[model samples]
Target: MSFKSIVRELKEMRDGIGSTSRRGGSGSRHWHSRTKSHIVPDVTLAPLEHVQQGQWANLPFDLLVDIIRRVEESETTWPARAVVVSCASVCKSWRAVTKEIVKTPEQCGRLTFPISLKQPGPRDSPFQCFIRRNRETSTYLLYFGLVPSENETDKLLLAAKKIRRATGTDFIISLVADDFSRSSNTYIGKLRSNFLGTKFTVYDSQPPHGAGMQLNSRSSRRFHSKQVSPRVPAGNYVVSTIAYELNVLRTRGPRRMQCTMNSIPISAIQEGGSAPTPTSFPQIIDKHFSPSPAAKGKGLISDLNHATLSEVPVQSEGSLEGLVLKNKAPRWHEQLQCWCLNFKGRVTVASVKNFQLVAAVDPSHNVSPAEQEKVILQFGKIGKDIFTMDYRYPLSAFQAFALCLSSFDTKPACE
Candidate 1:
């Protein structure tokens, strides 16, 4: 009748059943005996209810702001920007919070070109210049649009037409891969631009020895003599060392590109010594191009103010340094499982077709958090055969473009 009385009767019924089960000869009880004796107790307990949901939106504003700041500062991967954007889209409350957090340019990551680049069409919006890579071939076509047009496609097409007609060169730079796989891993390729193509090679001279057997007289003899030994081909050697070289193809002779990785500490290695220490940070260097003989003594001396017309000193090999590369330290990316560079936060995973070229800073010195916030150059994907480069510096557009192109190589991480 009463709540307490009914509860006592249910407990007494349960205890009686337990006592009978324990005294039985067999350990196992029948289905009828196991059945709960109390189907519905006379007592009416409180009805079940749902627990109240958490009030995440009601969290202190300052605490929320701190949480977002930590996330923005720590997330340095490729999808970091996407994660921030996602937070903004969660709800109006979150959106307002994120908006305040990203007000500073440094707080917001650099602009990205998510889509692969495509050739500019007549009606497409105009860009300063366009770098097009052929999908079917390993050729990169550089278009320097001298004529500025409202339409980006028209500008690129016009520039290509004018340069081709004047120089009789298509401005096509073909990348010929040495390896059969044609992947960026290791290859010797010719970067044919204008009429003369430059030869550049990226190869792993000292590959890891663990992956394959070294092809030597001793190993060959051991394999041949042992009937059970598996034959390993000479070509099955792994590359352990990596080197890059560029050669300028000239009419008279092929001159090695006069360049050096500046600011890199030179460590002397003894003959037949251990491997040379690997560079920690990427190096930036100036490339000097020897003046063409034909251009010598051709300048008019009359115009004192005309710097272009004045004869440049013979000793002064024009610095192609503006177009020179500013190499960032290649980092091991765990997600992409590749070696990449964060060029002022513009590029995460470096590729030949996609990379950023920022101003060269001392590698030994760490960049101040405030100074290293913005992007220097944003180059790479917009759509297929179409690429974008948003350069803020005063470097020559061609040189900047070329420097970005140089990054599309096989680095250690790629191997």
Candidate 2:
């Protein structure tokens, strides 16, 4: 059916909800109308038989479930998938049901809600996505698909604006394009770098482990400036850190890099293992609160440095910790006289920003060859202002995107 038809059904379902509330006794569940555009009456304003656009109707629970399930199953991809979002937007009851019916990215491998950006990708394969850069605005926009044309409508997954700093650089990531302020609801997280641009940290506005984890005072003071609604968290939780090693000798080679996923455990790299996934959007408790790039054309590089961006709280190491990712080394092509890693045709351009990531080897654990060679994440340039990003389990789109953004920063010491 057409999207309009689904919306019509949803409207009917919403109206049905109100009808049942009035006819049924006091024990019946009541759903509060939250949106300003829609209003729920305190008293019975009209007879049960009469209905209005804003009035609620009682849709059978089974029917409501079936309809929403169909919509969720039918529209699996974007633009078309917006129908599912529309269903959630209909009303409180609708939203609850839609959320229940929709599965997390780890289970379904589909991004139906905004929260999917922070959830781990499918364990079996990587989710293919692309990035579009706007040089004029110094903004980087991430889209859900490999959208080849600039004019075509792209499914925006996330947006990051590069803000340069005296000591280093910062990229404020958000759900909205223009707004980067941490106080705003659109603020999701950010990437911060050191003076030399050799080391970087990925910060999440909400706790990655869940609601129970609290941000330390130092992390809170570093970001929060204004009071925020209780629905969105205001603290900065470090999810991961990206560090490029400094080459003091000025060696001419591809950059070597490492990613320490603080939120994920080393056991996650093992077969049949899983990673932590956030269930809902973080809410900011009023009490809890709280860069541009230069290198235009360079290859991936890696090295180590002692200097850190700042002294942030380091979670005590547990038996489950130590999930480090190192850049997959590229083999030198004899004919081309350059290093190369098989992107499997996902990447077209040969920019220095291209690199693939895999779990770092640990002598303590015995990981299989398949898991060892699996590319957890890979990003490469396809064109000017366009790049391909593919990521799999243990890393969400947000983490993958933030790591890719690091490639855009000028790392003179590493290169």
Per-prediction TM-score, please? 0.27, 0.78
Instruction: For candidate 1, write residues 1-415 as lDDT tens digits.
Output: 5534533443454344345544653332321122221111101011111101123345578876776666556543333344444344333465567556643221132221110011111111222445665545544554433222355332121111111234222222211111222121111111112222232221121221111223455445543442221111111111111123342232221111211211111110111212112111001000111122321112211211111111111110122111123333345679977655543332333345454433343433343443233344456554555665554322223223433444343222222
Please list the C-alpha lDDT of all candidates, in the order they appear: 0.30, 0.70
lDDT of 1: 0.30
Q: After superposition, how far is residue 254 of candidate 1 from its true place, in Å?
A: 26
In the range 250-274, model 2's lDDT, one tens digit per residue, is: 6757899999888787767776666
Identify the runs in model 1 with alpha carbons over 4 angstroms from their true place: 1-129, 134-154, 157-324, 340-350, 361-378, 404-415
Candidate 2 global CA lDDT score: 0.70
Count residue pairs with overlapping backbones in model 1: 19
Error at 300, model 1, angstroms: 16
